[model samples]
Target: MHYDGVDYDAGMVIGAELKNGKVSTQIGFSVQTFIVYNPANGKMELMFIIKNGQVFLRTIFIDKGTIEELLIGSVIQSKNYQAGNTGFKIDGETGIAEFNRLVINKDFKIIGDASKIVLDNTGLAVYSTSGGVIKLSRRP
Candidate 1:
């Protein structure tokens, strides 16, 4: 994935284990930039477990000396689609970051989180709270 002129490889499974019909795993990824003076080194960790037909996802990001975490609730998957919501906390305030729908047909699209609509072809098309509709395309 490429963001902000930096290239990031796909996440990898760091560890995995299965026991008693349950499976747990950890995935990690790194984001890096080329500039030495203005460095941007970020790491992301995702931990998930599957038990009794239920799936939970937790994602944590460490970037530029800051930490952010997202604890996603149960994931419901259908043909070429999945949806879920994650616990979101900012500045000691808490809420849910709802991912109402994610459709992956010929392209990817996500709609939720207080009127936030993100399309794979368009970075952030709508942000209601910010009152702006900015369209950014991924750099090849």
Candidate 2:
């Protein structure tokens, strides 16, 4: 998590895994904004969360190529994540990676042991335990 080759501003990482469990990274962006950037590629992963009078941002940045690759891979793996009412969703705008397909699920988990699941459309597969199904053919 580096931006422009500099250490990521710790405050901008929300819901980021840390020494004290899944704590929200704290950055002062309108008291409700934080941005994540992956140094490897130079793209931006942005996320925002507000809880108990506090707002946090969760995002990641890397090169477009990397993001694209990730998206494609996500599409393929999405299928594996589906299970007994659990599903996922993938928007075309997400990327051309394997997992660009949208997924959907019900009664899913987001933290702890059930964080993310990987699937393989070509080789390996993965996915998340969240709700919804992978939604493709509707994105730009």
Candidate 3:
């Protein structure tokens, strides 16, 4: 799969699982973190995984020095699924942390949804939503 314009080589197949009568494949890899600018949420550093042709957002981190203080220590997880022909959705949440003195608590809720996915065989996946368009292109 592609992320931040880079196409990573397929790592070792970890395993597979049956879901809804279809086997989903899993692969694993490691790389330095990267950032994605979301029109709805600004910039976030993220790590992702792909299974069953679907992309899963595994982690989100904001450095302590970032300007967005409200998002400090925030974490996000999401999964992308095919909606229909040329369409898709990303359903997930961001765990928001509330700090009071020495106490901290996290609250998370469903957060993102992207529709109208246009896939380009030439190595591009375009996601269009009300906020704006996010184009993910593969590396050569």
Rank order by TM-score, top first? Answer: 1, 3, 2
- Report lDDT per candidate: 0.43, 0.42, 0.42
For candidate 1, what is the lDDT?
0.43
- Which candidate has the highest TM-score of all? 1
Q: Which candidate has the highest lDDT of all?
A: 1
Candidate 1: regions farther than 4 A off? 1-113, 129-131, 138-140
Worst 10 residues of 3 by lDDT: 96-105
For 61-132, candidate 1 gives per-residue lDDT tens digits of: 445574386544543222333332333222212222223223223354444444444433334343455465
In model 3, state the lDDT of residue 111. 34
TM-score of each: 0.18, 0.16, 0.17
lDDT of 1 at 127: 42
RMSD of each: 21.4, 17.7, 23.4
Tell me how far the alpha carbon of residue 37 in candidate 3 is from the true structure, in angstroms, after superposition: 60
Lowest lDDT 10-mer window, candidate 2? 95-104
Question: Can you write out model 2's per-residue Cα lDDT over 37-88, one digit (the tens) per residue?
Answer: 4555565544555655765556534355533333243333344544422344
